[model samples]
Structure formats: C-alpha cells, structure tokens
Target: MRHVIGREEADFVFIQETKSKELSDARCFVIWGDNNVGWIHNKGDEGSGSLLSMWPKDVFEYESHVMGTGYIAVYGQHLKTSYRCVVVNVYSSCSLRGKKTLWEDISKVRQSSHVLAWCICGDFNAVRSSNERKGITDRGEQKSEVNGFNSFIDSNFLLDLPLVGKKFTWFKPDGTAKSRIDRVLVTEDWLLLWPKSKQYVLRREVSDHCALVVKSVEKDWGPKPCRTIDAWLLERGFNRMVKDK
Candidate 1:
C-alpha cells in the first residue's frame, strides 16, 4: 500500500485496518517520505487501543489520547497532512461506546481554540445516510447509528466532500453490495481556507477498502501549458525549413 501511494506523490495519506500489533513501529516505510507523517494504530486484540507515529525530525506540539480505536491530534507546519493546518487521524470503534468516545475526543479538540484549520480522516465505521448504503436495508439499529453520525457532523459543522465515481469504498468480493464506510471530514474553517478541497478514491489492491486522496487549493495555479517556444524557434530560418519540409 505504501509503495503504491508513494508513486502518487501524495502529500498526506491515512490508512485504517493496518492490523499491526505494535504501536511504535506500525507504519509502512514508503508512507514516510521526505516529509512528516502521522499515524494512530489500534491497540489490543479486541481493538480498544491506539498508536500515533510521525516523521521529518520535527518536534510537534500536539495533544493526543487513546479512546476506543485510536485518535491523534497533531500541531505542526509543513507536515504531511498540511502545510499550515492541523491534521487529526482517527479510527473509531463500531460499538455504542465507540460513538461516545469519538464525540468526546472531538469535543475536546473544539474546546482548544489553538487549532485553527483541521482535517479529520479515517475509517468512521458508521454510515451517514441511506443513500450511502448499497445492499443493506436500513434496520432500526442501523438507522440509529446513521442518525448519530449525522448529528455528530452537524454539531461539529463538518463537511463530507462529495465523492466521485465509486460511492462505496469497501465491498464484498463475493459480489454483495455495501455502504460507503470510509471518508474524510473537514471543518468549516478548513473548507473556507481551501474552497477547492477535494477527495479522490484510489484503487484498492491489497486491502479490501480503497484509499482516499484529500487535496487543498493552496498550490493551485489553474490550468497551464507544459511547454513554450522561444522567439528563436520562430525565426525566418526555422519558418523556411518548415516550408521546405
């Protein structure tokens, strides 16, 4: 996964279901390029613990905690996740308590006014709307989960970028349909700072889920030609040679 992503020249990358046992050395080598990289891994067999990792040899002023799966709050500049924004990587559990844990973590971050721009990316493990599902019929319990997810986003004023092409990120190899489980959520302030922000689904090779690429408009220069001809190329001799040919 890291090798493939490295080729894409992505600034930041978030991965879930890494299935690593050790927290210290859980990240793939290729993901850690010449820039900074942050990660939070699930701890324990029951998946109740979390791990955070980063690179680039810069000390980051951060506040992080282990909820259910993992959540890492990073404060740094020119990092893999951002050039001038704070990046939070999270992996929430799929239980009732997990929802509460996620909410608590988010609330803590909101209380901290130090964070200006933020982008939270990971496997939420919960569907937001019925339109996000594929085959599973909305049951009472599922509806409740969806409602909780929507409420969380609404209260936080987060925006889920409109997905293009494939709606569902994960699917059963047996041909059964499923919901769009994985996503990248950004705060209103972050969107305002980067109005051209967008997320793209990368091809899934090793894992069952596809990877997401989130980009900001900080470096956009519109569309431009790749090459240009100098005045010498349009000289009389060059025109005469072309005419002779």
Candidate 2:
C-alpha cells in the first residue's frame, strides 16, 4: 500500500476492508510517507471490514466529517482549486438489503451537506453489469443485483467513470470467480471539472481485491466519443429541445 501511494503520487487515498480495529497516527503517516496527512478510519464490523481514508493535509483543507452506518465522508476545500467538496469513502455491505440502506445513507449525507462536487470511491461489492462478473453460480440473483446497483448510480446522478488497467478487480484464489466490484464514482459537477477522469485498477499485491485510483489525465484523440447520462432523457422538454436543435 505504501509503495503504491508513493509510485502513483496520490493526493488522496481510500482503503476498504481494512482488518485493523484501530489505526495509529504513526502508521498512517508512515503509509502516507509524510507527517502532513489527515484521515478517518471506521471501527469496522468486528475487524471484518473497515475503511481508511487519507489525504495530504497541505493539499486539502480538513473541515468536518460525518460518520454514517457504513461510510465516512469528509467535507473540505481543495487548496489548489479552492473547491469545497465532499469525498465519501465507502465500504458497502455485501447483502442487497444492507446495500440499499448504505445507498440511502450516502444520499442523505449529500443532501444534508449540500456540497455538489463529490468523488466517491471504494469497494462497492456490487457490479453494474452482467458482463462485469464471470463464473457466477446464480444468474438470476446476479441480474437482480445488477439492477439495484445501477439504479443507485443513476438516481443519485453519479457518474461511473470509465475503468482502466483491468477488467476484473476481484479474483478467487483458484481463479474460478472474478468480478469488477471496486470502483470510483463522481457526480456530474465533479465531472465538469475533469471530463477525462477514469478509474484505474492497480495490481493486486498480497490481497484478493485490486486497489482503485481515480485520475484525470487529459488526452486528445482524433474524434472524441459522445458521453451523456441517461437521466437527461427523462427531463421535461429534453426530447423537444433535442429535436429542435
């Protein structure tokens, strides 16, 4: 984890399923490779799952945080952009019912804070499409799961950025099952600031799940592809405006 942070030159980090019950400042500083680091760590569900979020204190100004059922969110302003935003670090439940509650919790947080620029990243433990999973034992269950997860992203107006580096983020020990459950999702306002942002899946070192990093590196291809969210079609007068245009 330390090596990845250093090599990637990360300004922020989100770690899920951390087994440690408590994290010391010394360990956090060591992992971040600096004393100037701010973070929030959950007590975890009996050491089975915990989230550790950290950022360079010099880069991002720490304001306040809200600790919900399964997530931790921090509100701060970026020193460089002076953009006040909320970055939610999540470690959602594996079960569908529990996942729904987690989604509601996040939505309420976003609503209460009224901060539109958001960058949510972590192990969702859910997939958005059927193709994202392989060797699934229950096709019916998987389909239902996909629908629920997709609905959450669409209804919240969160953009699931294009993935880079790997097709599957989780691999079974025997290589029988593989799924793309880890992701980084940002709201439309956040996307406007960085249109080319992408989710990068890093190498799985000493862990079953691959680490995910969100990066925005601009590139110019010959003809760019059109990108838009589906919710726009449901808005009143959208169809007429498109036809008139």
> Tens digits of per-residue lDDT for model 1 on 5-115?
111255445545455566543234454643354454545354343433343334333345333435655555543444455666666677766776786677667666466
Candidate 2 C-alpha lDDT tens digits along 8-96: 35667877777888899999999778899998888788766777888888778999999776788989987778888888888878887
Weakest ten-residue segment in model 1 by summed lDDT: 1-10
lDDT of each: 0.62, 0.80
Backbone clashes (count) for model 1: 1
Pairs in steric clash, model 2: none
Each candidate: RMSD to true structure? 7.6, 10.4
Off by over 4 Å in 1: 1-8, 23-68, 79-84, 217-245
**TM-scores of all predicted structures:** 0.70, 0.83
Lowest lDDT sum, 10 consecutive residues, model 2, at 1-10
Compare the candidates by lDDT and give the number of the best one: 2
Q: Which residue pairs overlap in candidate 1's backbone?
A: 43-49
